[model samples]
Target: MTDRIAMIAVDWGTSNRRAWALDSDGRVLAEMGDGEGLLKVDAGGFARSFADFAAPWLTDDRVVPVLMCGMVGSKMGWAEVPYIAAPADLASLSRNLYAIAFDGPARIAIVPGVSCIHDGVPDVMRGEECQVLAVLTQRQMRDACLLLPGTHSKWVQVKDGRLDSFRTYMTGELYNALTSGGTLAQLMEKGEADPEAFRRGLARAREPGSGALPHLLFGVRTLGLFNALPRAGLSSYLSGLLIGTEMRDALAWSTARAVIAVGSPRLLENYRIAAGEFGLAFEAHDNSALLPPALHMIARDAGL
Candidate 1:
């Protein structure tokens, strides 16, 4: 027979949901997920949706304590769990969880997001904060600048194992909007990742000027129109431009000398390359390795 799951770990996001059946020692017993994200979960459907996805593991005749993190805790998600102010550690995060009595026998707790003021500007991160905590703990990083790339990319600074400050970059979403349905959609052509053209875009993004972004973005179309940038390379070039701009700006605010990129392999690769441009060493850790221990730490402290 399979090992008993001691805790149910859930990572619910805007687009997807993943739940892991974890044993007492935080080992994975089984896993399941779906597209029933916050966006798709209708009003009052969160409990039903969660129970359905977790049905297989719920066969045991007991209520399983669920520790969930991500956009599921956002205002638009199941419940509007308030954000935990920044300069916090795992202990603070675990202590401030938002709990709810499920319609069924199970007990559910949502991890609150973290907010910080960097350079007099307020920034917040929901799911990424948990990931950042996991990465810092797993790596035993004392002082590190961490990058989590996504639709809304995050650059977090950790000092002495506590979250000091961070910044959010709209790189991925901007690229998506520009290519998918935005004004520049007509100019971009899908193609394989081209390192050369990508580097060219990165260089363009680094050009010093007052209105460089708009000017450089327009260059993508003009360059393609004049047959300067190949159609097959336009997508990669645009990706480089966006990521490069993010790196160029984010790297300045970060105090750590090297960076740790935490995300998928493809996204990490882009960040690694971008970090190399600024002569910063890059390290990576996937979600699977970083998340399990992180969740356990938080849940345990929360008495879940």
Candidate 2:
């Protein structure tokens, strides 16, 4: 590799695309991104979209190595990079990655996501693996629990710098669905997180039993129906119920040295609060903080 080679790292997700140009020292030289996510771009036009965003940095002498992550590795995106089952390290993931050439003067390599079979169910992830690996690299935490809160909250268990196992919860998606399509939508108002109501719902979810979810959901309607809990707090109540339930279940197998929460501040804060309520110790870091190291690891692993 040339000493002055410009490497680009791309995190292309369902709703957005972010690209960063890095120097040899892993310092960001230029950054560009847009909302032309995989879901928005035409299937055949991915190369064009990427070229449009990366064109200004392209030079005749430069052969940029692009390390991509996110939905770009999915079947609906550019090319399907099949996931490698965990107990995986950076070297192993890079060795198993699937790459393709671009019409432009660049060497493109996409990061393969991770998948694991738990209890006979196949669970998969794309972009979040990069962040988790990045965190592991940065913090040097040998064994830790990684919590990524989003549309599908992921509870990942990494041991000795390798992914051991993980589980996914549809807390955010379910909250959206219930608020938008379910009958609870009419009884709730669009509002911010209500800490008090969230605490109450969390307590309800932590109860010892198998039918906790159904029972709590029943209460969501019954309370509204009987004018027990305030109508405005219904959304927050439901949010807490789902998140709390996830936390309760995850606690059963959370035997890590530390818990690392990654995501936006709002979501991380809620997770932090929930963890505290559950008597768990955790640290929260914004998702962006994990990007640079993640890209660096990807580049190193890809031999860029």
Candidate 3:
């Protein structure tokens, strides 16, 4: 029932937004999701967009606080929530939350992203931190490396319950770029997915003599031209190559022997395959199960 709901947790991304109505213990009571992400918010402003989205849950006889994460707090969002630098923990996220003023009965707050310097290269993540928190806490872990795969994949390290550092890999974005439109895109038209092709690509990534990826990437088309690889399998090959390459470097990037992979099942499947190729072990976790609990934890800590 609506009365049983305590808060609404929104994970607003670039192209989509998903919100959950949760009970006092962070258990889901109801849910809603749509393509109305940050970029798609109506011109009425974020408050309006939020009001429209939460209309179903805001049927409150009592106030239902809203906790949001992701681009909703970025410079382009309702308000720019300054990032909390690493090594960051759950407490830091709660402490640095940015509030949005509204006349609605419930208060609204957006969790700030985290920034870290990994190997002198500055990296930052918006929505993934909450998932990281959930993973660590759910698994009863104080130290672990987490892999959050998506358009921009993140390899995060947590130590003593804090996000020590993380690195971003443009694996998924690059895949889309290559296949969206280009010479490579043309070759993938009739391609059937081939696991062997993917495995071969993964093997190619780990080869010492494969040289730099830029030099090797062109093979996706050449193999097709020579009939050495099927056109339909080229996409799978490209996927394996990129993910395998990420694994090759990421495995070396962190000292953690195994990683906890978090994200949609569809996205994590390829990563799981790549992990197998690298002889690396990983545990898959669905973000949907993790984010709400994490948001609730943040809300509780923020005294919402």
Candidate 4:
């Protein structure tokens, strides 16, 4: 923990923020995180908010290098960094870093997000681009599909070590909204996972005539009411249904031969299960691989 710090790597997003103090060799020396997301930090309060977590590094005499990614570079972040167009790689991302002029000795750089025009519609991502780079670089992958699952799941394609295209799904958000209130929530608790019920939900999503999700979601309540699904395990069923639909939608856009799932164990397992049910190939990746090396590469390339 007392190692000489080389750089501060940060992953700041909408709901939370985390930072790591890395040594000269890109080894993490210490780490910290807080729930003060972009939404919680008030207007013109980014510097103050950041200092709360990174104060120890932002000293008077040391020009501690800091590299940040995610929503921290968005319009609502400390600075509104523009998004780098798609068909980009680590080089482009590093080149477009938005440097924040700190009055102190800390040198701050924010990684730009990625954007693309898909089928005449605009799509954007704030944080997952870094994760994509980390995976592609570490695996020496030239072309592949990468999935970062969370509230807003992302399906990204990397070609020739560059990010080519991506799409987002609100699977987790929809699950939260549906399970937080209404008839479904009333009958459900944070139930122990029922693998059978979960499979049933996935099956429902894949059914030949299952119709749209609105109708399928309504069936969750009906199944509970009719005792078709146990009330205690209704939550898992809803989760499977949403995740299944997400996979179904994403399959159409993903051109890569196989998909790499990147997230926590639970998240990766869920996506793996869904991918399996869909008969799609999947590989689990360590989420920890996303930040440290990616930040180091960017900082080194940028001459930080």
Candidate with the greatest TM-score versus the true structure:
3
Instruction: List candidate 2 segments past 4 Å from native.
Output: 1-5
For candidate 1, give the lDDT.
0.83
64-158 in candidate 4: lDDT tens per residue?
88999988888778899998899989789988989998766678999999999988998899878888888888789898988999998998888
By TM-score, is 2 or 4 better? 4
- As a whole number from 0 to 100, the lDDT of residue 136 in candidate 3 is 86
TM-score of 3: 0.96
Cα-based lDDT at residue 177, candidate 1: 81
> For residues 184-255, could you state the per-residue lDDT of candidate 1 as single tens digits?
678767777899998888877777772457777888888888999887788788888888888888876766
Task: Please identify model 1 stretches exceeding 4 Å from their true place.
Answer: 1-3
Off by over 4 Å in 4: 1-3
Q: Mark the regions of model 3 whose C-alpha exceeds 4 Å error after superposition.
A: 42-44
> Where's the lowest-lDDT run of ten residues in candidate 2?
1-10
Superposition TM-score, candidate 2 onto the true structure: 0.94
Task: Give per-residue CA lDDT, model 2, range 1-304, as digits (tens).
Answer: 2335468788888889888778877887767788988888896988998888888777766577888888899998899998989887788777876777688878888888899998899999898888988888888878889999999999999888898889999999888888897778877876766788888888888877737677788788888899888888887778788989999888886765457899999788878888888888889999976776687777786686
User: Total clashes, candidate 4?
Assistant: 0
TM-score of each candidate structure, all chains considered together: 0.95, 0.94, 0.96, 0.95
In candidate 3, what are the lDDT values of residues 100-170, reduced to their tens digit? Answer: 89878678999999998756788999989999998888888999999999889999989998999888999
